[model samples]
Target: MIDLQTKLVGLIGKPLEHSLSPWMHNETYTRLGLNMAYLPIEVLENDLETVINGIRKMNFIGFNVTIPHKISIIPYLDDIDPLAKQIGSVNTITCCNGFLKGYNTDGEGFVSYLETSQGINCSDKVFLIMGSGGASRAIAMTLAARKAKKIYLFNRTIEKAKQLASEIMSYYDCICQAKNLDDTTLKALIKKADVLINTTSVGLYPNIDQTPVKYDLLSSHLIVADIIYNPLHTRLLQEAKEKGCGIVTGEGMFVNQGAKAFAIWTKQPAPYSMMKRVLEEKLI
Candidate 1:
């Protein structure tokens, strides 16, 4: 009883079996009575070009990129959204008029979710971001653009952190600094931070016990946010919560970013309630 005329949309990445995009998008399609099917395409690093070309040739309307492919797929794209280009990564892509255009909804989604869900204003907050990967870049840049008082990035590797911080400072003309993730420095940063965000994949499903920062570094004054949703409540967030700090999970970011991407492709408002319900059902 399935429609033969359904359009195709999906996510492309290596090891995509763990993704929740298909469920999220399919639920929206079913609720809205749209003839669309979302899929997860497991693409290998060596076969990125071939997979992209294949998608272009097929009837797929769009696709989401994740992990190792986010930045690497940029050069293969025919066009890139300015914001995505500035962020140096793309998590969403749309096919229009036979051309693939890349976009980074992660930043917009993260900022919007923080404002609406937590009600934590970013105007003058000193934000401390852990990790210097794509998600960190997007979040840091968004905070800087919003005129955050100051932004600091901590990473195990000093050079990588410094590089990301320098880029943000240059791009946004804001006070951005990078530091090595040492006990003393982390303790100091945690004490002074109003909002602490983790953009690394440390506490994801398979590695649920690991947290980038120690529990001793956390304080009740800090607002901790983790971008890992699979296990939902990460150890870092749990510890922060135990310390009475406000916490936000990665689920908000996932839903918001997916909604934004859906809007970009369909040119309509996403059914947020339906999307969230579907995810909850699956999680249960």
Candidate 2:
């Protein structure tokens, strides 16, 4: 049912061949009877300028950004949401009359998922986040915005973790500090934190057995979350649940993020259930 009249939206990043966004977004459009096509346009770092220029010339509604472009896309955008500005990254973009507006929905998506899927609230909760990459940045920024009481951030590289913690401390009133993953102090903090989030790719496909922390170290009092959805249930999550800890999978964040993007582009309610099903089907 697609034609020249179909509105165009897509993703821009190198190595986009591995992205499942097109499948999830296209299925949503088709299921909703909307004439829109979401494509995965791989644009290398050197070609970002050209691709952005082309987006302005075309009839594109909006698109998503990934990897290297998230922060780099800032100057090119006509406007930016405050959340995106604070996170120092942009993932969703809206085009209006050739004007591009940048947004970072990753944090919103993650927060919304925790709230609706697990009855978790950011305020007054202590978070123990593993990793200091883009995913962790978004989640940490969002939690800070939501007024989380404290966050004990951990990373293999202490400097990277400290940098992120410094940013949070500079901007928010929350008690955020960096700690070493192998440190006895961080391990003690984890046992008492309200939530434990694994934002690293250690538990991803091929490394299915790898986890940020040992399973026996997990506490039943903590709500564990891993932001790797490929296997649906990572080893950390399996171990957490087995020890009677509540767990949140990466699937909720993945689906909710796209749902936010869909809402942004269409200005309508996304079929949340179907979007979840589409990705679940792909994983299976």
Candidate 3:
């Protein structure tokens, strides 16, 4: 059905061989009867500028940004949405008539996932985040804006966590603390945390056994959330479940963000259910 009129959209990132965005977006387009094609484009860091310039010249509707490009791509963009600007990261982009605008759906999308799946509010909640990357930054900023009581961050590099905590505290007026991840500190923090978020790729596919925290430390009162969708159920979630703790996978986060991007590109209500189902099937 593709003709001269068919539109093209894609995801751009290094190591995109594992991405499910193409399957999810293309299936959604098919079900909605939209003449748009979605695919994954692997672009190395050094080639980002050239690729971006090519995007400007092409007839592409838009493309999703990922990994190292999220933060680094900001300068090349013509404009950036407020949320993306504040987070200093962009995961979604809108390309229209040579004008490229960047936006970050990660914050709202993750919050939406939390609300939809757990019926939980970030207001006055205590969170333990296990990373200081772009994903962690967006999630932290959004949770802070939600007026979360406290966000305890732990990263392999303590300085990165401290920097994120300082930014979150200064920008959003929330209490954020940076701490080193160790058996002693993790156990203490878990006892007080209402939720634990894994923003890293520890339990991602091909390394399914790696977990950020030991399941033995988990409690029934804690809610474990991970941002890896390939496996649907990460080792962290499995361990959380073993302790009768509430758990959420990254599937909802991934789908919710895609829904936001879909709306941005098409100016139509995304087929949310179909997109999620497509992703689920692909993950399985």
Off by over 4 Å in 2: none
- Can you write out model 1's per-residue Cα lDDT over 112-217, one digit (the tens) per residue? 8987888867887899999988898888888888888899998877798899888888878689999888889989878788999999888888889999889888
Question: What lDDT does the true structure give each of the candidates?
Answer: 0.87, 0.90, 0.90
What does candidate 2's lDDT look like per residue over 95-176, in tens digits? Answer: 9889999988898898889877778778978999999988899999999988998998899998988999999888899889
- Over the full model, what C-alpha lDDT does candidate 3 score relative to the true structure? 0.90
TM-scores for every predicted model? 0.96, 0.97, 0.97
As a whole number from 0 to 100, the lDDT of residue 282 in candidate 2 is: 95
Residue 168: error of model 2 in Å? 1.5
Give Cα distance to truth, residue 26, candidate 3, Å: 0.9
- Report how far off residue 121 is in candidate 1 (Å): 2.2
- Candidate 3 local Cα displacement, residue 10, angstroms: 0.9
Clashing pairs in 3: none
Where does candidate 3 stray beyond 4 Å? none
